[model samples]
Each structure stands twice: as C-alpha cells, then as structure tokens.
Target: MQVTQTANKNVLDRVFKLSEHNTNVKTEIMAGITTFMTMAYILVVNVNILADAGMDRGAVFAATAIAAFIGSTVMGLLANYPIALAPGMGLNAFFAYTVVLGMGYSWQFALCAVLIEGIIFILLTITNVREKIIDCIPSVLKHAVTAGIGLFIAFIGLSNAGIVVNGATILALGNLKDPLVLLTIVGLLLAAVLIAKNVKGAFLLAMITISAIGMVAGLVELPKGIVSAAPSLKPVFLQALSVPAEQIFSLDMVVVVFTFLFVDLFDTVGCLVGVASKGNMLDENGKLPKAKQALFADAVATTSGALLGTSTVTAYVESAAGIGDGGRTGLTAVTTGLLFLLSLFFAPVFTAIPTQATAPVLILVGVMMASSLKEIDFSDFTNAIPAFLTFAMMPLAYSIADGIIFGIISYVVLKIATKRAKEINLSLIILS
Candidate 1:
C-alpha cells in the first residue's frame, strides 16, 4: 500500500508539478473540493435556465456535468492552471432568454452561434491575439478587474442568500427576521470569524457548518437518494450542427454569432484576469503563462458544450475560491473535474447543498480578493477614473464584459483626449 501510494504521488507530481507550485496533495484536494462544492449549483441551475429555451432538462443536466468535466480536466492537463470551467451564468441566460425566447430564434440556432463563437475563439488563441489583448490591459485595470469580480461575486452571494433583493429603492436588505436570512447571517459571521482566526480551509468549513445547521433547522432539505441513474444526452446532442446552411448564412446568424463571440471573449478574459490576479498568477507584464493552452481549453469546452446541447462554457470567477484556498497547480482542477464526473451519479446530494450554505464562501472570497483594490494607484485621476468604472460597472451592469468594455473605451478616450496616445498600445485602440 505504501509503495502504491508513493507511485501515485510520483505520477501526480510529474503531471501537475505540485511541489514546484508550492502546494501539496492535501491542500490541492481541499481546494478542489471547496471549488466543486461552491460551483456544483451550475448543474441544476443551468438545466432549469436552459429548459426555458425548450431543451430537455435531464439532457441539459447531463451536458452541464460533462462539459464541466471536460473543460476542467483539459485546463488542468493542457495549461496546468488551477482554474475550473463551467457553463457560465450570464452566458446561459443570454442563450436561453435573449436568443431563444426574446428573439424568437430556435435553441438550435443559438447553439450554432455558440459553436461558431468557440471556433473563432480557438482561432484567436492560436494566433495569439487573445493573449496579446489580455497583456494590453494596463496593470491598474487588471487590479481593478480583480476588485470588480470580487464585488460581482459578493453581490451574487448576497442575492442568492436573499440577503439582498431588488426594490423600489433599487437595492434593499432582506428581512433579518426571516429564518433563512437569519441562518445566512449566522453563516456569514462564522466565516468572517474563521477568517480572522487564520483558519485553514475557512471557507469550506463555513459552508459545511451552515449546511449542517440549515438541515437541522429544517431549512435545507435532505436528498431523497444518494445516487441515481445517469441521464442521456441524446435529446440535445449535436443539435447545433443541424442548422441549415441557408440559415447559417443569414444576417441574423451573423448578428447572433457576433454577439456570442464578443460576450464569451471578454467574459473569459475578465475571469482569467480577475482570478489570476487574485491568485498572484500573473507575471510582471500582466500576462498569465501558458495562456494559449488555457484559452484553447475554454474554446474546446464551448464547442463541446454546444454540441452537447448547452450554452457557452467559460472560465469561472468562482475559481478564485480554490486559488484562495492554496490551489496553485492543475491538481486542483483535475480534482474538481473528477468531482463533476462523480456528481453525474450523485446529482441529488450535490444539488441539495443550498445557496445559503455557499453564500458565506462566496462573500468571504470576495472580501479576500477585494484586497487588490489597495494595489491600484488612485493618485492618478486618469487611471483612477477608468479603474473605478471597470470595477463598478461589473456589479452595476451585472456583466463582466460590460465592465471591461466600459473601462477600455473610457481609458482610450481619456488617453487620446489627454495627448497620451503614445502610452496606449495598438491592441488597446482595437479593443476600444
């Protein structure tokens, strides 16, 4: 047993270079588990959201897990980065609500758009255009991106836990008297306290604590079954490829495909920038290493996800949680991928982990990541204004791509107006 264990460790070390990244097996595994626990909600949420577009719920469920597994595993092996990928939250809404329901296009048409976008992404990565664009982002804006994502994540947590809700006032606090909200507050406080004590795996511990409390308090329902039969993917599989050639060449197709390409490109870039900065993975030039491989993995996931009858698969900002938990190597991503595959059979149990339980984890990671704000140089008004807009627009506009778009345009306009065009790169001008 000891020799077998040593052999397995050797293989992991060679593959992930865990020691070189200064992370061990136990830490990476915990980080992966923490990430999977927080992100597992995508399985059920993606299915429900896609179902509105008239897709099969069971098939979408299967697709979500399979896409996650493929994306995360490929990211681990191809790029050796700890980041995990999944069907992105905002992208899915646009696929279902805007493209399919609002625009009256079929879901298959939307999937074709997604597939086209993925192909374009792969091409961009191959040409190094994507990596160059990421590098063109100014250092201050990169830090702002991290802070913006932190705020965005925190807002998501608050809204998910019903601690924040829309009102005539635009935003208002939830009733503290409500049992669920009260429980959320308890979890929030405990997480904060754990973080203060410098506890290892504080976020994971908080989630577990809240889940247990909620179950005992009759808030979180227990799963009906520990394991279940896997769902078939046949209903939605390869439907994207079925779009007629005439439809594919239509103007509507052009517009839809462009929209998908634009959104996925920037959202993935924002996620990579935000989470990489939070994890201190970027170099002095504000560039991530092996970015081509990372991006290629994302592109492949999107194409596969579309073929499997889902929306765009992109790198997730939630990955910062695992990075914050000491995940520095691909081992973390591989572990998360394995869990996603395992979740296929254990869907009920994974789905039963309430949003309230993961709420504290998201909120805490937000606080931790927001420290990047301190790194921004507020002394320069030119930098300050764009940076502020970049971070603010994320949660306010409820879109990471919008935040980046606003920031880049403003930065370029400001620089050109101020006669600092020499400081701007050609890529920046094109991006604007």
Candidate 2:
C-alpha cells in the first residue's frame, strides 16, 4: 500500500506541479469537488435548455458530462491550468432560442454552425490570432469584464435560488416566505461566516451542510437511487453533418455561424481573463500563459460537444470557485473532470444536489472575481466610462458579448472624442 501510494504521489507531483503551486493532492481534490458542486446544476439545466431545440434530454445530459470531462481533462493535461470548461450558459441559450428557434434553423444546422465555429477557433488559436486579440484589450477593461462577469454570476445564483424573480417592472425579490428561499438565505450567511473564519473547504462544507438542512427541512428531496446507467448519445451525435447541403451553405447559415463564432470567441476570452485574474495567473501584460492551449481545448471541446450532441463548450466562470479554494494547478481540473465522468453513473446523487445548496458558492465566488475592480483606475474618465458600461451591461444585457461590445464601442468613442485616437489600435478599431 505504501509503495502504491508513493507512486501515485510521484505522478501527481510531476504532472501537476502541485508543490510549486503551493497545493497538494488533498486540497486539489477538495477544490475539484467544490468546483463541481457549484457547477453541477449544468447537468439538469443543459438538458432543459437544449431540449427547447428538440434535442433529447437524456442525450444532452450525457453530452454535457462527456464534453465537460473532455474539455477539463485536456485543459488540465495540456495547459496545466485549473480552469474547467462546459457547455456554456449563455452560448447554449443563444444556440437554442436565437439560432435554432428565432432564426428558423433546425437543431442540426445550429450544431453545424457550432462545429464550423469550433474549427475556426482552433485555427485562430494555432495561428496566435486569438492571443493577439487578448493583448489588445486594455487593462482597465479587462478588470471591468471580470467584475461584470462577477455580477453576472451572482445574478445567476440569485435567480437560481429564487431570491430574485422577474417582476412586472424588472426583477423583484422572490417570496421570502418560501422555505427554499429561507434556506438559501441561511446557506449564504453560513458560507460567509465559514469563509470569514478561514475554514478549509468552507465552500464545500457549507454546501453539504445546507443540503443536509434542506433535506431535513423537507425543502430538498432525497435521491431515488445512488447510481444509474448513463444515457446514450447516439441520438444526436454527428447528426448535424447530415443536414442538406443547400441549407448548410446558405447566407443565413453563414450569419448564424458568425454569430456563434463571435459570441464563443469573446465569451471564452472574457471568462478566461476574468477567472485567471482572480487566480493571479495573468502576467504583468494581462495575458495568460499557455492561453493558446486553453483556447484550443475550448475549441476542441466545442467541436466534440457538437459531435457528441450539445452546444458550444467554453471555459466557465464557475471555475473561479476552484481557484478560490487554492486550486492553483491542473490537478484541480483533472480532478473536476474525473468527478464529471463519475457523475455519469452517479447522476441521481449529483442531480439531487439542489440549486439553493450551490447558490451561496456562486455568490461568494462572484465577490472574489469582483475584487479585481480595485485595480481599475476610476480617475480616468475615458477608462472609467467604458469600464462602468462593461460592468453594468453584463447583468443587464444578460450576455457577455453585449457587455463587451458596449464597453469597446464606448472606449473607442471616448478615446476619439478626447483626441486620444493614437491609443486606439487596429484590433480595437476592427472589433469596434
């Protein structure tokens, strides 16, 4: 047993650089569980979202897990970054509601566009074009994007926990009298206290504690079973390639493809920079090392997800949860990926984890991501205006692309108006 344990330690130490990152196997494993608990809602959420496009629920559940497993594994092994990738929240919504439904395209055609977009992403990453784009983004704006996503994540958590609801005006408080909302409130306070006390795995412990309370309070249902066989993916896998040639080559299809490409590109970049900043992974130049590999993993995941039957796979902001838990090495990602794969068989147990249980983690991680806002120079009007817009528009517009677009446009306009056109680069001009 000692010999086997030593061999396992050697491999983890060598591959993940755990010691260099000031982490260990135990901490990485716990961080991985923390990250998964916070984001496991995606399994059920993805099914509901994609099923709107007429995809099979069981198939999408399998695809979501498999795609996340593939993306996180590749990211861990290749980039050695503690980031996790999954079928993204906004991208899936766009795929189903915008492209497939509003654009009158079939689900297969939408998947085709995603596949093509993934191919384009791979090309861009390999040629270093994506990295160059990251360089063009100003530091202030990067901080703003990070803070904006923080708000966006927190908004998602609030909505999930029934603390916020769509009111007749805008969003109003949900029923505080509801038992679930009360539980969420208690969970948030408990998590805050645990974190403040510097409790290790505070996030994970809070989740488990709240979940237990919820179960006892009859707010959360116990799982019907501990394990179940994973669903088949054959229903939708590679089915997009069978679309009619005419439809595939249509101008409308081209527009749809561009939309997917555009959203996935900026969203992934924004998420990586935001999450990496929280982990102190960005260099002085505000660039992530091995970013190309991360982007490539995202691209490959998107393609494989479409082939395996899901929407655009990209880096998730929820990854910041792992980083917040001291997950500084790729072992965290590999651990998260393994958990996702294990979830395929233990779906019932994971699915039983209620949203309210995870909601507090999202709220807390959002606070951590937003902490970078202190780095932004609010004294400069040109920088402040765009930064403000970027931060505000994320949760308002409910889309990362919209927030980024507003910020870039405002930045260009402010620069030109202030006779600072020299600061504007060709990349920003083109992007604008």
Candidate 3:
C-alpha cells in the first residue's frame, strides 16, 4: 500500500513538472505553431515545381520535408532558439524559372551552385568573417534590413492574396472584380479586427478559419491532399552536386554563387536579429546568444537540403510570427520541426490549407515587421536615407538582396557625397 501511494505521488510530481513546463514553455510552442502555419505554402508549391523540372516530385518533397524537420528540431534542441530552416522560396524560384528556363543551365549544374554556395557559407561561418561583416553593419542599417524584410514579406502576402497582380505592361493591381479577391479582402478585414481587439493567435486563427470557409464555398481550389512517396536521394543528390570544373571556373558561375551566398547570409542574419529583438532575447549589450550556433545550423541545413535534393535551405523570417505570439526557447521550434516531419506523411492535409487563409497571416506579419520602421532615427540623414532605401526597395525591387544592396550602396554614396566618408566603417564600405 505504501509503494502504491509512492508511485501515485511520483506520477503526480511528474505531472506537476510537465504542467510547469507547459506554463513556462507555452510561448515557444505557440511560436513554432505560428511559424509552421505561415510557411506551410512551401509544401504545395515546391512539389509542383520539382515535378515540372523533370525531377522526382515526391522525392524532393520528402527530402525537403525531412531536412527541414531535422534542421528545425536540432536548432530548437541544441540552440534553444526559435528559428526555422527550409528550402528558400526565392532561391527555388530562381533555380526553376531563372536558371533552368532563362539561362538554359542544366538542372544538374544548378545543383552544383547549391553545393558550392553552401560550402562557402559553411566556411564563412567557421572563419568568423561572417560575424565581422555583421558587426561592421551600422545598427541603423541592420534595423532597416530587418524592417525591409517585413515590407518584402508583406508584398509577398499581397501578391499571394491576389490583392496585387503582376502584369507585363502594367505592373500590378487589385482584382476588384474577382469574388475570391473580395473574400480575401473580407478575411483581411476580419483578421485586422481580431488583432485590434487584442486576440491571441488572431492572425493564425483568422487565416485558417476564413480560408476554410472560402474553400467550402467553392471559391478556392482545394488540393486533393494526395502525396506519393518518391524518396530517392542518391541520383538527385549526385545530379545537384556534379558541376563541371569548367563551370566552376566560369565568371557566370562565380557571380551566381557569390550572389547566392550574399543573399542567404544577410537574409538569415536579418531574420535572426529581427526575431530576436522582438523576443527580447538580446543580451544587455544587445548581442544575441549562440548566434554562431544558429548560423552554423542554418548553413548546415542548406547543405543537407542540397544533398537531399532540394533548393537552398535558410533561416526563416516567418519565425517572427511565432515570436510575436510569445514563443521562447528551442522547444517551440522542436514542436514545429516535428510537425514538418509529420507533414511528409500527411502532406495532403497541410496542402488543403488555402492561400487565402495564409494571406491574412502574411498581412498581419507584414504589419508587425513594418512597425519597426518607427524605431529608426529619422533626424540623421545618414540613418534615415539608408533606412528609406532598405524599407522602400524591399517591396519595390521584389528582392531582399536588392533592397539590402540598394541600402548599402546608398549609405556609401550618401557618406561620400556628404564628405563624411571617414565616419563610415571601412569594412562596411569595402563590403558594400
């Protein structure tokens, strides 16, 4: 009887401990869930693109899904941070549409770019050169980059929502006549209302709920939710890595890989810094903990993704959505990572989530990201000019790297023109 009583007490103690963890760890889990939902669109588009590229669609999806899961889980368990890693949206588009379609490069050669760039990224991380570059960036410019990402993401949300459609002659416009567009507008309004009313998970909840209604009303195309297992690694992995020596020596390849490296680095850095700030994870000196580990994790994830036959993997800015929802610690990221892994088996269900649903979430995230612009020092032209370039160019240029480049170039130009070139950091000017 005494033994039984002890066992019961032990179980109760364990339960209490778990309850405590849940209470304290609730933020991380919420953040992970929020981030996962925001990025779920990748599962659909990625598979389709791979299939069109004459690659094994199922294999690519399986690989990407698995790599993302593992990378995200490790990042959570090892780093105690809430960033996500996945095949990058922009890079993949560039690979399929630009490299394959425009440049007429073989898919195999494109894969070579992924491998080389990833290795370079890893080297950059280990050498501490990456850190120095980041440190050299003016605090104001860094903030602008972060804020610019917000604008860039917001533009993505708008484009996805059909609220803005890109065209050849005319740039873009709202689809006022489309009922689906009307529904999206309504959903956006609903999400805004809920957010203004101070509802927790308002963005996520609104996105899922409204998109479901739109699907049921036959306004949105519902994916059949069918996923076939095409998990081949050796062939595709080899194909992606086998760049000819000649190709590597070519100026064009050099340019492409350099571009890829530059974009991935700042994109990841901007995301980490932005989300960390929002989470209040910055130290007393305003430095982030385990930043190297986070950077290494991202670099490794990209390489692993390439080996597994997917596009470049990088840290996600969408993680901010979860940070805004009160996620802290790697536990939340682990939870999210687990979900992505499980998604391989349940791809159909996730694919069922309509675009209109995600639109509201993206819009909310945009609002959150863009709000940081208010924090920039508007009085100093040095700060304000770069901030403007970073903020405006993101959406306008439709590229994060372009926005960052414009900001960097403008900063250098402004400093030189104002005869305050000496005030600028030498390393930063050189890098720009």
Best by TM-score: 1
Candidate 3 lDDT by residue in tens digits, 37-130: 8888787787677656667776777877877887787677666777877888788887777777778777777677877888888898898777
Clashing pairs in 2: none
Candidate 3, residue 280: CA error in Å? 3.0
Runs in model 2 deviating more than 4 A are none
- The TM-score between candidate 2 and the true structure equals 0.97
| Candidate 3 lDDT | 0.75
- Could you tell me how far off, in angstroms, the CA of residue 134 lies in candidate 3 after the best superposition? 1.8
lDDT of 1 by residue, 175-201 (tens): 879899888889999989987997878
Question: Highest lDDT among the candidates is held by which one?
Answer: 1
Clashing pairs in 3: 27-327, 28-328, 28-332, 59-230, 225-348
Q: Put the candidates in TM-score order, highest first.
A: 1, 2, 3
Model 1 scores worst on lDDT over the 10 consecutive residues at: 194-203
